[model samples]
Target chain A: MYSTTYHRPATVDEAVALFAKGSDAKYLAGGHTLLPVMKQRLAAPSDVIDIARIPTLIGIEASSETLTIKAATTYFDILSSADVKRTIPAIAHLTSVLGDPAVRYRGTIGGSVATNDPTADYPAAVLALNATVKTNRREIPADAFFQGLFTTALENDEIITAIAFPIPEKAGYAKMRNPASRFALTAVFVAKLKSGEIRVTATGASQDGVMRVPVIEQALAANWSAAALEGITISEEGLMADIHGTSDYRANLIKVMAQRAVAAAG
Target chain B: MANVQLTVNGKAVSADVEDRTLLVQLLRDHLGLTGTHVGCDTSQCGACIVHIDGRAVKSCTTLVGQVDGANITTIEGISKGDELHPMQAAFRDNHGLQCGYCTPGMIMSAIDIVNRYGADLDEDTVRHELEGNICRCTGYHNIVKSVLDAASRMKLSIAAE
Candidate 1:
C-alpha cells in the first residue's frame, strides 16, 4: 500500500533480477497476505515483483509418486482439480475449507506456504505429506521449510517456484476452525507414507508453530486406528493460548483432531 | 504510478493510478461506479466483491496493478438497460436485503455460486457458499431463498436461450 514500484516479470530470472535491483522487494503472488500487511503499514517494501503471472508457476502435475503444485496456483484450482482430488483428496478438502470462496479464488499455495502462518492450513499438509518446496534458489524439504510462526527457511529474496508432495499411502486432515477468520484453532494432519512411516502434525496449537505429534504418530504407526489413540493425551506445555482457547483446551483438541484425522484417513 | 487498462463492466477503460491503488478504488473512485461498496477495508466482508475475469474476488484486497489486463464486472454492469439480472430480480422478489449495503456483493457472489454449482443448488450449498458475503442485517434467510430462486430462474433462461 505504500508508494512502491510494481514489476510484473515473465520469468523467475527476471523476477529475481527485479528483486535484486530494489532496495527492498517482496514477491507478489496472490496478494491476499502481502497486500494486507502492506496496507496496514506493517511492511513497506521498495518494490513488488508480481510473480503470479509467471507461466512456470501456474499448474498442477500429479504423477504416481508425487503431486507437483506450481507456486501461484490458487486454492480454487486445487479444490476443483480432478488431479488433486484423485491424488490427495485430503489436500483438496483442506483447500475447500481454507478461506471463503473469494479468498480461495485468489490466495495461492506458495503464498500460504511462504508466509508460513502458524494458523495456516497448507503447512500442516506440507509437513505431514513430506513435501519438497522448490524455490528459485533451492529445494527445501517440509521439515526444514517452516521455522516458526510467520517464519520459513526462505531467504529475503528467495521466491518459491513450486511444491512437490510425495503421494502418501493414506492421509487425512481435520481442524477446529475459528469461526470468524476460518483459521484453524487447532488442526491435525495424519499421513501414512509409502515408506511405511506415519507422520502426524498439529498446527495452530503450538507456540513453536506446526509440530509433529510423536504420540499420535507412534500410536498410528502401531495400530493405524483411531482406537489406538483412545488413551493418549497431549501435554499442555508449549501449546499456544489466547482468548480463543486455553493451552489445556488446545492440547485436548490436538488429541481429538488427530484421532479424527486418522479415522478420516481410513 | 501505473497505467491500468481493464475491461470493466464490458467497457474498455484505462486509468493512471498510484501503484498502491486498490481495484475497488478504481471502480468506485476512478470510474464513478459506487455500487461496489467497501464495507470492511480488510477482506473479511465481501461488500467489495466483483467478477474479475468472471471469478468473484474482493476488489478492496486486489490492487489495480495486479489485474491490469483483466475483465472486471461489477454490480452496475450486471443489468441490461432497465432490466434487472435474474439474480437481482430474485433478491427483490424474495426481499433478500434490509439496509441493502451488502446487496451488490451478495448478488455478485450468488451469481458465481450458480455458475459453479449450477441450477441444482440445494439449501445447504447456498448457505455454505454464502460464507464470503455477510449480510449484517441478519437477512440470510431471504438471501438464501433469493439465491435458490435465482438459480431456478437462471436455469429457465439458459434453457430458453
Candidate 2:
C-alpha cells in the first residue's frame, strides 16, 4: 500500500475541512473497499479522511413510512437493528447474507453504494425500493444515483450522509453468489409498494450496473405470483458476460431469480 | 507516520507506524504476534481474523490507524498461560487440523460464531457461518465437530460460572 496521510476527525465539519485541504482525498468509511484497492496499488490518494469514527454518520432510524440509514453504518448494524427488521425485513435479510461475518463487521452500506460495484447486494435493494441517496450537497433518487459499473453521481467532495428507503408493503431478495468471493453472480430484489406499484431490480447480471426489469415489474404488478413471470424472457442485450456465466445465462438467471424473489416475498 | 495506541492481549501497546500499515503487519512485525497468518492478502482468506472492539474483522485489510484506542484480541489472547481455550482443546481432541496453517483464524472465527449462535448451533449453521474461514485439511468434518464440541463445552463452562 502507498503511504497516505490519515485524518481521524470526530465531526463532519472537521472531516470536510480536512478533505478540502487535500489535493486528492477519499473518505475512509469502513475501508473494506478502499483499503483493498490501496493494497493492490490500484489507488493512491494523498489523504484519507476517516469518516467511520464520526458520530453523526453511524446509525439507523426508522419512521412509520421510511427507514433512514446513515451511510457509515456497517452491515452488522443493519442486521442487528430491530427497527430495520420491523420496517424493511428484506434489507435486514440482505444485510445478513452480505459477505461473511468478518466482512459484515467492517463493510459499510455507504461505501458499498458509493463504490457502486455491480455485484454488491445493497444497490439492488436500494434501487428496487426507490431509496433516496442523501449527500452533503443534494439528494439523488435511486433511479438517478447509480450510473454504471463502479460509477455513481457523487462528486469528489460530496459525502453521502444517509439513505432514506420508503418502506414497501412487501419485498424479497435472492442471489446466486460466487462460490469463492461471495459476490452476486446474478441477484434480484422484488418490492411491492403501498401504492400498488411493483419494482424489480437485478444486479451482477447487468452491464450497466443495477437495473430495473420493467417486464418483470409489469407482470408482477398485474399478478403478484411467481408464475406471472413464466415465459417472460429477459433480453440478453446489455447483460454482463463472464467466465461465471454468459449473457444468455444471466438473462435466464434474471428470470429465475425474479421468480424466486417473488416466491420468497410471498 | 501515525502514532497508534491500543490494548493487545490485555496489555496496552503503542506504536508509530506508517499510515498504510495494516493491523496484521503491526501485530506480526512490531509486536511479534506471529500466530496470526496472512493467507490471501486480498482479504478473502480469514487467516488474519481478529477481534477489534469485540467483533471479528480481517486485520490484514484494516489500517493500524483505524484501530487506534481499540481493544484487539489475536489468537495468542484466546487462551490463558498454560490452559488452552476450550476451542483450542476441542480442536486438539477432535483432530481438527492437519497442516495447521489456517488453525488460528479458524479458532478465532469459531469462538465468534459460538458467541453469536451459542451452544445450540446446528451443523448447517456452522458450515454457513464458517464460509469466511477456509480449511483445506480435514475436509471441514473434524473442524465442524470441533466447533460444535467447543460450543457445548463453552456453554457448560458458562453455566458452571
Candidate 3:
C-alpha cells in the first residue's frame, strides 16, 4: 500500500475537515474494502481519516415505525441485535450470511453501503426495505443512493451517518452465495409494506447493480405467493454472466430466488 | 509514521509504524511475535486471524492505525507456560493439521467460534463458522472434529470451574 497520513478524528466535523485538507482522502471505516484495494494498488489515498470510532456513528435505534442503524455498526452487532432480529429478522438474517465470522466482526454497514459493490448484500436489503441513507449533509433515499456498481450518491467528503429502515409488514431474503467469496451470486429481497405495496430487488445478478424487479413485484401484487411466479421469467439481457453462472441462468435464478424470498416472508 | 499502542497478549506494547502497516506486520515483525502468520494478504485465507478486543478479526487486512488502543491476542497467547489451550490440545489430539501452516489461525478462529456458539455447536454450524479460515490440508474433517472436541472440553472445564 502506498504511504498515507492517518487521522483519528473524534467527530464527524473533524473528519470532514481532515478530508477537505488532504488530497485524494478516504474515510476509513472497517477497512475491509479500502485496505485490500490499497494493497493491490487499486486505490492510493493521500490521507485516511478513521471514522470507525466516531461516537455518533456506532449504534442501532428502533422506533415504532423505523429501525435506524448507525453507519459504523458492525455486521456482528447487527446480527446479534435483539431489536433487529425482532423487528426485521430478514435484515438480521442477511447480516448473518454476509462474509465470514472474522470479517463480520470488523466490517461496518456504512462501509458496505458506501462501497455499493454490486455483489454486496446490503444494497438488496436497503432497496427492498426502502431505507434512507443519512449522511452528514443530507438524507439520500435508497432509490437515489446506489447509482451503479462501486458508485453511490455520496460525495467524496460526505460521510454516511446512519441508515433508517422502515419497518415493513413482512420481509424476507434469499441468496445463492458464490461459495468462495460468499458474496451473493444471485440474491433477492422481498418486502410487503403495511399498505400492501410489494417491493422486490435483486443483487449480484444485474449488470447495472441492484435493480427492482417489476415483473416479479407485479406478479406478487396480483397474488402474494410463490405460485404466482410459476411461469414468470426475467430477461437474460443486462444480467451478469461470468464463470460463476450464465446470464440465462441468473435470470432463471432470480425468479426462483424471488419465489423463495416470498415464501420466506410468508 | 503512526504511534500505535496496543495491549497484546496481556502486555502493553507500543510501536512506531507506517500508516499503511498491517496489524500482522506489527505482531510478526515489530514485536517479534511470529505465531501469527500471513498466508494470504488479501484476507481470503484465515492465516492472519487474531482476537482484537475478544473478537476474531483478520490481522492482515487490519491497519495498525485502525486498532491503535485495542487489546489484541495472538496464537502465542492462548496457552499457559507449557500446557496448551483446550482448543490447541483438541487440534493435536484430533490431528487437525497438516503442514501446520494454517494451525495458528485455525485455532484462533476455533476458539472464537466456541466463544460465540458456545458448547452446544453442531457440525454444520462449525463448518459454516469456519468459512473465513481455509485449510488446504486435512480436508477440514479433523479440524471440524477438533473444534467439536474442544467445545466439549471447554464445556467440561467450565463445568469444573
Candidate 4:
C-alpha cells in the first residue's frame, strides 16, 4: 500500500478547491475501484479526497416528472429508498441488481458514470434515460460525457454534483453480469419516452464503452416488440474480446439482452 | 489525527485517529471491539458491518471521522444483558453460521434488512440483498432462515411488549 494524504471536505467547492491545488489527486466516492487500485500500487496519487462528507453530492430529490439523484448517493440507498422506488423506479431497480451487496452499498452513480468502465451498468441507463450528469462546472449530456474506455468528458478539479433523469412513461434495465466481478457483461436499457419516442442503449458490449443502438432504437420506434430484432444483426464492430466472452458473443448478447429488456419493458 | 466520539453499543467512545483511518481499524485497533472483523481489505467482504444512524454500512470502507457523532451499533451492542440479540439467537438456533467469520456483519446486515424492509424477505430477496456479505459455508440456507425467523421473533416480542 502506498502512503498518501487524505482529505474530507464538507462542500463541493472545498473538494474542488483541493483538487485544483493537487491536480493529480483522486476523488474517493466508494473506493470500490480506487482503493483496490491504490493498494495494488496501480494508482498512486499524492492525495486521496474522500468526498462522502460533501453535503452537496448527497440525497435524492423528485419533482413531478424529473428525478434528481445526487452524485455520491449509494446504490443501496436508491434501492431501499421509498421515494426513489416510487418515482423513476427503474433507477432503483437498476441499483438493486448492480454489482453485489457490498459494491452497491459503496459504489456511487457519479463515480461509476465518470469512470466510464465499459462493463459498468449505469452508463447504458444514463444514455437511454437521456439523463444529465451535473458537474461542478456544467451539466453534461450522457451521450457526450462518455467518450471511450476508462475515459469521460469530466476534467480535473471537476466533481459531478448530481444526475437528473426525466421519468419515462415505461422503462426497464436488464443485464447479463460477469459472474465473478458482477460487472455487466452486456446490459441494455430501454425506455419509452413520454413523447412516444423510444431509446435503447447497450453497455459492456462495445469497446468504446456504451453506444446508442440506432437500429434497435429505430426498430423500437417503429414497433416496440421483442420480435423486432428477429432479422436485424447488431454490428460487432469495435467490441471488446476477453476470456469471459468474445466480441461476437457480446454482439449477439446486445441483441439478446436488448430483446429481453424490450420484453421486460412491454 | 482527528478527535472523534461516537456511541457504540450505547456507550460513547472517543479516539484520535488519522483522517485516513477506517471505522473497522478504529474499532479493532483503537477500541478493541473485535466483534467487527475485517475479512477482506477489499470492500468485497461485509465482515465489518455496523449500523450508522440506524442504517447498516460496511465499516471497512467508511472513514472513522465520518461517523464521529452518529449513533453507531456493532455486534457487541446487540445483546441485551445476558440475552442474545434476536438475530444471534436465530442464527445459533438455525445453524446460520460456520467458522463464524461473517457472523457479525451478516447479523448487522440481516437486522438492517429486517428493520428496513421487514422479515418478509423471500429467499431470492435475501440472496440479492446478501451480495455484499460473502459466506463460503452453508450456501446461505440457514443464514436466510435465521433472519426470517429472527424477524418473526422480534415482531412477536415487540408486539408482546
Candidate 5:
C-alpha cells in the first residue's frame, strides 16, 4: 500500500468534511476490499476516512415494518443479531455463508454494497428484499443502487449511512460457491413479501451485476413453487463468463439455484 | 504517519506508523510479534488471522490505523506462561500440523470457533468454520480433530473454573 493520510472521524459530518478536503479520498469501512486493492497498487487514494469508528454507522435496528442496518455493521454482527434472526433469518443465513469467519468479522455491509462486486452476496439480498440504501445525500432503492460490475450509483464523497430492508413474509438464499474464493459462482435470493409480491434476484452470474430474473419472478408470483419454473430458461446473453463457470453454465445455475432457494424458503 | 495506541496480548503499546501500514506489518516488524504469518496476503489465506477486540480478523488486510485503540490477541498470547492453550495442546495431541507454517493461524481460528460454538461443536461445523484457515499439510482431518478436542478441553476447563 502506498503512503496515505488516515483520518478517524467521530461523526458522519466530520467524516464527510474530512473526505471533502482531500482530492482523492475514500471512505474506509472494513478495508477488506479497499486495503487489498491498495496493496495490489490498483488504487492510490490520497486520504482514507475511517468510518468504522463513527458511532452512528455501526448498528442494526429492527422496526415493526423494516430492518435497518448501519453501513458499517459487519457480517458477524448480523449473524449474531437476535433481531435479524427473528425477523429476517434469510439475511442472517446469507451473512453466515458470505466469505468466511474472519472475513465476516471485519467485512462491512456498507463496503460490500458500495463496492458492488459482481459475485458479492449482499447485493442479491438487497435487491430481492427491496432494501433502501440511505446515503448522506439521498436514498437509493436497491434496484437503482447497483449500476454494473463493481459499480454503484454512489457519487464522489457520498457516504452510505444505512440500508432499510422490508421484512419479507418468507425468503431464502441459495449459492453455489467457488471452492477457492468462496464467492458465489451463482447465487439466487427469493423473497415473498407480505403484499404477496414475489421477487427473485440473482448475483455472481450477471455481467451487469445483481439483477432481477423477471421470468422466475413472474412464475413464482403465480405459483410460488419450484416446479413453476420448470420450463422457463434463462438466456445467457447477459450472464458473466469466467474461469469458474461459463455463461451457459451460469444460465443453468440461475434456474437451479432459484429452485433451491424456493425450496429452502418453504 | 498515524499515532496508534493499542493493547496487544494484555500489554498496551503505542507507535507512530505510516497510514498504509498493515496490522500484520505492525505486529511482525514493529512489535516483534512474528507469530502472525502472512501467507497469501490477499485475504484468501488466513495465515495472518488474529483477534482484534476479541474477534478474529485477517491482520494482513486490516490497516494499523483502523485498529488504533482496539485490543489485539495473537498466537503468542494464547499460552499461559509455559502452559499451552488447550487448542495448542490439542493440535499437538492430534498431530494437527506438519510444516507448522499455518499452525499459528489454525490455532487462533480454532480458539475462536470454540469460543463461539463451545464444546458441543460438531465435526461438520468445525470443518465449515475452518474455511478461512487453509492447511495443506494435514488435509484437515487432524485439524478438525484437534479443534474438537480443544473445544472439549476448553469446555471442561471452563466448567472447572
Candidate 6:
C-alpha cells in the first residue's frame, strides 16, 4: 500500500475536518473493502480518516415502524441482531451470506452500500425496500441514491451517517453468487406492496448498477406467481458481461432469479 | 512514525510506529506476538483473524491506531500456555490441520461462531460462516468437523461456567 497519513478522529466534525484538509482523504469505515483495494493499488488515498471511533456514527435502533442502522454498524452486528432478524430477516440474511465471519465482522453495511459494487447485495435490498440513506448533507432516497457503477448520490465531501428502511409487509432476496468472491452474478429483491404493487430490483446483472425489472414487476402485479416471470424477457442491453457470466446469461438469470425471489417472497 | 499506545492481549503496549503500520505489524514486529499469520496480502484470508473488543476481525486490514482502546485477543492469547483451548484441542483431535497455516484463523473464527450460535449449529451454518477464511489444505471437511466439535465443547464449558 502507498503511504498515507492516518487520522483516528473521535468525532465526526474532527473526521470531516481531517477529510476536508486533504483532497484524497477518505473515511475508513471497516476497511474490509477500502483497505483491500488500496493494498492492491486499485486506489491510493493520500489520507485516511478513521470514522469507526466516532460514537455518533455507531447505532442500530429499531422501532415498531422502521429500522435505522448507523454507518459504523458492522455486518456481523446485523446478522447477530435479534431486532434485525425479527423485523427484516432478509437484511440479516444478506449479512450472513457476505464473505465469511472475518469479513462480516469487520465490514459495515454502509461501506458495502457506499462502495456500490454492482455485485454487492445490500444495494439491491436498499432499492427494493425503499430505504433512505442519510449523509452528512442530505437524506437521499434509494430511488435517487444509486446512479451507476461505482456511483451514488453522495458528493465528494459528504459523509454518510445512517440508513433507514421501513418495515415491509413481506420481502425476500436471492442471488446466484460468482462462487469465487461469493458476490452475486445475478440477484433479485422482491418486495410485496400492501396496495398489491410488487417492486422487483435487479442487481449484479445491470450494466448501470441496479435497475428495476419493470416487466417482472408488471407480471407479478398482474399475477403473483413464479410463472409471472417466465415469458417476461429481461434484456441485457447494457448489462455487465463479466468472466463469471456473459450478459445474456445474466439477463436470463434476472428472469429466473426474479421468479425464484418472487416464489421465495411468497 | 507516531507514538501510539494500545491494549493488546490485555496489556498496555506503547510504540513509535509509522502511520502505515497495520495491526498485524504491531502484533508481530512491535509486540512480538507473531502467531497471527499473514496468509493473503489482501484481506481475503483469515489467517490474520483476531478479536478486537471481542469481535472477530482481520488484523491485517485494520490499522493498529484504530484499535487504540480495544481489547484484542490473538491465537497466542487463546490457550493458557500448558493447556490448549477447547477449539485448539478439537482441531488437534479432529485432524483439522495439515500445513496449519490457516489453523489460527479457523480456530479464532470457530470460537466466535460457538460464542454466537452455540452447539446446535448444523453443517451448512458452519460452511456459511467460514467463507471469509480460505484453506487450500484439508478441503475444510476436517476443519468444519473441528469447529462443530469445538462448538460442542465450548457450549458445555460456557454452560458449566
When just chain B is superposed on the true chain B, each candidate scores a TM-score of 0.99, 0.98, 0.97, 0.95, 0.98, 0.95
Report the TM-score for the A-chain of model 5: 0.98
Native contacts kept (model 3): 0.90
Tens digit of lDDT per residue, candidate 4, span A1-266? 45566777888878878877874798989877776677667887877888875777989998878889899998878787787878766677678778776566678988888888888888888889888999988999887888989898999768899999888888888789875567888988999978777889888889888888899899888888889888879877898889999988998998898888888777
lDDT for each of the candidates?
0.93, 0.92, 0.93, 0.83, 0.92, 0.84
Off by over 4 Å in 5: none
Write the residue-wise lDDT of candidate 4 on B34-147 in tens digits.
999988777777888898888778787776666778898999999998999899999999999999999999999998888866757777878777777888674489998898
Candidate 4 segments exceeding 4 Å error: A80-83, A101-103, A195-197
Q: Give per-residue CA lDDT, model 6, range A1-266, as digits (tens).
A: 77888888888778888888987998898897888888888888989888875788887899987889998888878887898989887787677667777777777888888989888888998898888999888899999999999899898777889999888777878889866577888999988755555788988988788888888878877888888677888777988886787999999998888878777777
**lDDT of model 2 at residue B40?**
87
Return the lDDT, model 2, position A173.
93
List model 3 lDDT by residue over A1-266, tens digit each.
89999899999999999999998999999999999999999999999999998999999999889999999999999999999998999999899889999999989999999998999999999999989999999999999999987999999899999999999999999999987788999999999987788999999999989999999989989999999999997999999999999999999999999989998888
DockQ measured for candidate 1: 0.81
The worst-scoring run of ten residues by lDDT in candidate 2 chain B lies at B130-139
The sequence of per-residue lDDT tens digits that candidate 2 reaches over residues A1-266 is 88899889888888889999999999999898899999999999999999986788889999899999999999988999999989998899888778988999999999999999999999999999999999988999999999999999999888899999999999999999887788999999999988878999999999889999999999998999999999798999999999999999999999999999999899
DockQ metric for all predictions: 0.81, 0.85, 0.89, 0.39, 0.87, 0.72
**TM-score per model over all chains:** 0.98, 0.98, 0.98, 0.90, 0.98, 0.94
Evaluated against the true structure, the overall lDDT of model 2 is 0.92
Clashes counted in candidate 3 amount to 0
Tens-place lDDT per residue, model 1, A114-218, is: 998888899999999999999988999999999988989999889999999999999999999987678999999999999999999999999988998998888
Question: Which window of ten consecutive residues has the lowest lDDT sum in model 6 chain B?
Answer: B1-10
lDDT of 1 by residue, B31-140 (tens): 99999999977787899999999999999999899899999999999999999999999999999999999999999999999999999899999988888888889899
Ranking by DockQ: 3, 5, 2, 1, 6, 4
Q: Model 1 segments beyond 4 Å from truth?
A: none
Cα RMSDs of all predictions? 1.0, 1.1, 1.1, 2.5, 1.2, 2.0
- What TM-scores does chain A show, candidate by candidate in order? 0.98, 0.98, 0.98, 0.96, 0.98, 0.96
Clashes of 4: 3
Model 6: which docking level applies? medium
